[model samples]
Target: MYSLKLVTFVVLSSIPYFCYGAKREDFDLQKMFEDMGEEGNKMRDECFTENEMSLADLHDYDKAEDIPEKELCFYKCFFQKSYVVDKDGKVIIESIKAIEEVKDLEESDRETFTNCLKEIKPVLECKDMVEFEKCFDQILM
Candidate 1:
């Protein structure tokens, strides 16, 4: 099952890094967050509407099993903003190592998480991107 806490944690934890290493004038913190928030909300609403679920459902539980099909779409939508979202909406073995560059995770955990997902079967399919994210969340988070 996927944990939204971990999903938000890992993704939120990277905000600083995404903002840093750029020219000061080139980065507008307020505008950037505003944009992300808008995009996030738009995706969230769209997913909820399409999946026939409500955002309130997100508060209903912690387990992935409790997650509704449409709500899962939010994960895929959020991931779309980053390179982390694969073009095929599936988890990419080689591309996942990119998380290694993310300072939030330790070296040991990274390998373990990657390998664990590698062992999982349904996770290998991108037929459902949200489920793919859930698979990674179960391990990586």
Candidate 2:
């Protein structure tokens, strides 16, 4: 359950990272996830399983280099499943903002998060996870 919270935090923070000239548009985040049902949960479990990661491993990433390639891709999978990232792997900021968690953020935190998202250009590949993680830290940590 704790791992799920970690995954949720990671998703909301990094969801805005994958934009690459992709047009932003608002989406019904609640409806989107509702439609997904257990698909997201399945992906989360699969990512952890495939990466051989445990909840303990989640806290071990103190640095970008400390994150494994598999873990980075796991983030991508989460965002993709949420549709915050398109099939082409481009992030839609509006879609991210539509998320209930992101929406509920305090005003100042939301501004910081928005800025971080705009500044970071993530490719949804293993190599760029560090950049996204760095931006996420600045916003929420």
Candidate 3:
């Protein structure tokens, strides 16, 4: 059985990504959650190894205020593999367009939006995934 802690992380971690991402086939997210058993753990372990990251540095969900670089990469890689996040760590523009409130943004704001997304690219462009997320948060604000 998956630990309660891991389960909580799955839910919490999935929300922001899903809320911001374009819709996919039905049960894709659900399958990702369900598959996080043996194969998932192994994949995560391999990702940590490949990324020169250590599982020891990973923080629990409650302490996830600022993820460490390597740990963040692990999550990023895993989510990308799961198709929950794009390879570039962006909120797909299609997803943004599908939202009801997004229709109301002024055209000028769209430039700001596009620029902000471009700025976020540099974050993902680097090797440090935590910084990528941080840069996204900063530029996206």
Candidate 4:
């Protein structure tokens, strides 16, 4: 009976893990942005500025007729590293180690300014200033 109870407890605990790993087919960026409201726009703007690319420029790049394969691959890799998708299709923040490389900033030179790192938690870690803004908006919303 004790062995059976132990097995049951283990199975019960694992159930949450399995359920959490289930793929979410309805992940909506629009809804998330809407949820963020003004804060989302601010974050997006900050991200664009930090990346040195305007929203129009990014849109144009995405809509480019002939984007280089290597560039596309690089973007994919970058997104994957930032987003932290798991084998089970669940997304989580993996690491924010890149934040440590920042140099020569005034008040914003700390580990993470604007609480972006704390906001993303363990699913979408932000490594840099640009990513921090993006993740901050996403988490805030």
* TM-scores for every candidate against the unseen true structure: 0.47, 0.61, 0.40, 0.23
Q: Which of the predicted structures, 2 or 3, would earn the higher TM-score when compared with the native?
A: 2
* Global Cα RMSD, each model: 10.9, 10.7, 10.7, 18.8
Cα lDDT tens digits for candidate 2, 1-141: 334444455555534332211223223222222222355567766665767764334433335565567666766666565565667656667766766677788888877877776677755575665665565666555
* Whole-structure CA lDDT of model 4: 0.31
lDDT of each: 0.44, 0.56, 0.47, 0.31
Superposed model 4: Cα runs more than 4 Å off:
1-36, 60-141
TM-score of 1: 0.47
Cα lDDT of model 3 by residue, 27-138, tens digit: 5544554455665666666766777865444433322244445656666666455443476576455444333344455666655554554455432532444433332333
Best by lDDT: 2
**Candidate 3: misplaced stretches above 4 Å?**
1-35, 60-65, 92-141
Best by TM-score: 2
Tens-place lDDT per residue, model 4, 1-141, is: 233223222322222222222222223221222232343345444544555544333211211223333322322233333343333323333322222222222344333433454554332223222232343222222
Ranked candidates, highest lDDT first? 2, 3, 1, 4
Which model is ahead, 1 or 4, in terms of lDDT?
1
Q: By TM-score, how accurate is candidate 2?
A: 0.61
Model 2, CA-based lDDT: 0.56
TM-score of 4: 0.23
Total backbone collisions for each predicted model = 0, 0, 0, 4
Between prediction 1 and prediction 3, which has the larger TM-score?
1
